[model samples]
Target: MAKTIAVEYRVHDGPDALAHAAAEHFLEQAQKSVAAKGKARIAVSGGSTPKRTFELLANPKEKFLQAMPWEKLELYFVDERTVPPTDKDSNYRMTREAMLDKVPLKPEQVFRIKGELPPEEAAARYESTLRNQFKLEGAEVPRFDVLALGMGDDGHTASIFPHTAGIHELARLVYANQVPQKDTWRVTLTWPVIIQAGEVFFLIGGKDKADPLHRVLQGQYDPETLPSQLIQPKNGKLLFLLDKDAAALLPAPDASGKGKLEIQR
Candidate 1:
């Protein structure tokens, strides 16, 4: 199955600016989806880079609260630690404190993985939740309107760590990925489901991310070695939002100073 990958790169002056750009892009996408479908499904990733963006979305500044159609937005986590939701490390907890608590969504509108459960059971429960909420027909993967992802320094996304089982998964929509190096497990949406999104945004920043971002963009396509490189939306948009620090290692930009936004067919 040959697919064309269109990537858009938008670099900002700093982390705060980068977060603002991401928030604006998210708002545009959410509004578009809600207008077309009466609802928006978004799967968000957890990481320091995304925290600022989530917070910006929740804050009332610039009439953001009024601008966003929160009632029509359903939030889901792309991945979660095996710890309970109350844990500080839990993605759900971070999202709640940063955005969900301030949003206008009902409890039923938020689908969170039960990290307290066994990893496999947690994954199954989340998959079932997706099927029921999205009214997915048999063999139909949940297609999110927006899938916001974070890239790790190792080029991993959504707990699909380098050389992990999650990267190799093709049949399953969700699964528990074990990282023996950390002696822990995490529940994540597998590549099959992720690539079904209408839009996938990789919000990345910081100098530490420079090397991996460069590798994922410029290096060979090796999902097993660099899980982030695996993301290729079959019929959707792939956007990479980077701060200047993260874009520093890429090749020099043209006179317009915009970093490269390559589209590979």
Candidate 2:
């Protein structure tokens, strides 16, 4: 028999519920990790899912933000659409406006992708900056405390779109490439870097993503057909934080000793 995928899940009836739970869960994990390690290094995702999570965290009413150690959290991007920081397409800007502005996270702790520069230059500079900041002399990739990700209907994670040659790049920390269908380019953290995460969360949402999510979770999909399928972490743990609609294609846990899919309100 084929080895089964090990995935823990938390399904919410809607996005707001999921976002609140996810934000709280993320802070708890980040806090605990920081408490033990003295710092939390996280590579965050782009798209509406992260925007919702950040907005939830940025809620001025949340006293928890004041108590947590924001200074100890080093924030990095999982990917950047090629645009200026102020551009609507820029993930760097979205994260800053959503979370960094309200929190007292120090400016130095926010490492942004310089998408304003020429694509090649941006990738090179960002790569060099990552190496220096992490002080990674002998390591293939910097180990991050957490990696938060979002998925598209096409099963693309970050900017790694389906059928793109970038999917085969298992060696670079970041890559500058084109997604032909969309006729756009992006700079993304490759699997080499993402797999080094101590914890990786797939923040998938929307009704459109249901089909591909099933394909990915089952491992029957081709990597070239669904980019997110290639995201099976070699060492890190994976979690799928989903909304109810996105779970439509998934089967129920079987009686044959399949692992339980954990869920909560």
- Per-residue lDDT of model 2, residues 1-265, tens digit only: 3333457766777888778777877888789889999998888988887789898887878755775678789888989988999998899899988888888888899999899998878888888889998887755588788888888888888888988868998667889878899888889888768867888888877899888888777655577888876666655347888887886677653443123442210
The C-alpha local distance difference test score for the whole of candidate 1 amounts to 0.87
Residue-wise C-alpha lDDT for candidate 1, range 1-265, written one tens digit per residue: 5455766687788989998888898899999999999999999999887889989998977556779898898899899999998999999999999988987889988999999999999999998998998898778899999999999888898989987888888877789999875689999999889988999888989998999988888877777888988898877468888888998888766555455556453
Top model by TM-score, which number?
1
Report residue 259 deviation for candidate 2 (angstroms). Answer: 7.6
What is the Å distance of residue 89 in model 1 from its true position? 0.2
TM-score per model over all chains: 0.95, 0.91
lDDT values, one for every candidate: 0.87, 0.80
Candidate 2 Cα errors over 4 Å, as ranges: 1-5, 252-265
RMSD of each: 1.7, 4.1
The weakest ten consecutive residues by lDDT in model 2 span 256-265
Q: Which stretches in model 1 have alpha-carbon errors above 4 Å?
A: 1-3, 253-257, 263-265
Q: Which candidate gets the maximum lDDT versus the true structure?
A: 1
